[model samples]
Target: MRAPKSHVRVALATTLLAGAALTGSAAAAGFAHADSSRAGDANIAPVGRADLHPEASPLFSVARRLPKVSADQVLRLAESQVGVRENGYGGGTKFHDWYMNSPRARETVARDGGKVTDYRNAAWCDMFVSWVGDKLGIRPAMGWDAYTVSHASWFKENKRWGTHPVRGAVVFFGWDGGKLLHNIDHVGFVIKDNGDGTIQTVEGNTGNGKVEIRTRPTADVVGYGYPVYTA
Candidate 1:
């Protein structure tokens, strides 16, 4: 989570891998109350942690032309990014560059009380999710946003929020492993439910700040947002 100003910075914990810290699901099917602020730890902050990194910013690059793809293709596309990492302080990767220039960034900045540039190296888990949606040419159905709470709220508003894990579902997580919206700490795609009260997921901005496949207990999930995939 971004710690700049009123935004809360998230302290990582072992909600994910054992002895490791940090880490989603549907609409509000199993959730009791989900406010917009409960996006994710990375979702809520305008900037993450303390900005200890000297700002060696990259020159803005043009967003790539997105190729139209189907929902069935999203996992493959998301999987292809498995090893990508930030250039530290969240500045590297096509995700940051794309979000920096997109109209969605302007929208988020308008509502979230931050300059567009403050996102330069801000916590970027949600940005990575947005990037994949744009890449697959499904931004409307797949949805996109910098803040996970707002993004998850979008799904709720659209009546897409739910409780169960389905392949390709956008997952919302709370650090406390509870069902409240404000506790949400991260976002990712559900690969599958392991059926042992565990899930397999691919997430950005995790595990030393790289995209990783992780096994997490269901207790950590706030819910899932089901993007309309057939569009």
Candidate 2:
């Protein structure tokens, strides 16, 4: 016998409601399963904090309020380290320690046939620039070598080498007028163009192993390596 039209409608509606309930329950269970899979993972945040509730977290608020790093900020960071001095001859200064603590420090030391512990007192002008780059998140790609020649060559091969000065560019120096990627002796971060064929720079391991802000004639600069910074 054919059921009443109203009864058929009610039956269909009941089936749809039951199906929806089952689907919702399955979805919730799946979410729970996924959450459990990450239960002991140290990188996973706690349950209440797992979601992206930036407004609810103080850390996120502080991060949001922090200023964006630009070329000017990078120059400032280099300037702030200007007064750092080496402790002795072999290794011990904060600047050297900073470089040694960098993620690639071990590789750099090994490549240079240097002891990791002795890197603190090495001719670290290049390492200082590298550390600054690492802090600014512009390194490795910007060339993180502790050797000036290696760093300059990396820049040249990457097409970042130039003679023109840009603020925050890495300046390579060769005391004997050696070429840019060869015989490079020291490196520093350029602060500004003096407009008189010179540039002001903050350099490490200068004038008795102290970081100093100094003026260098453009003629002494073999080349400038520009970092890929947005600002």
Candidate with maximal TM-score: 1
- Give one digit per residue, the lDDT tens place, for model 2 in 1-231: 011121111111111100122223534433112232322233322222223222232222111222334567778888888788777853467766776676555554444454666554467787678777667665532457556666776566444567777787889988878663555678998888899988999998888877899999887888887654533
Measured against the true structure, the TM-scores of the candidates, in listed sequence, are 0.71, 0.66
User: Which 10-residue window in model 1 sums to the lowest lDDT?
Assistant: 14-23
How accurate locally is residue 204 in candidate 2, as Cα lDDT from 0 to 100? 83
- Give the poorly placed runs of model 2, Cα more than 4 Å off: 1-68
Cα deviation in Å at residue 192, candidate 1? 0.6
Off by over 4 Å in 1: 1-71
RMSD of each: 15.0, 24.1
Q: Write the per-residue lDDT of candidate 1 for residues 83-117, one digit (tens) a residue.
A: 99988766677788888888777655655676888
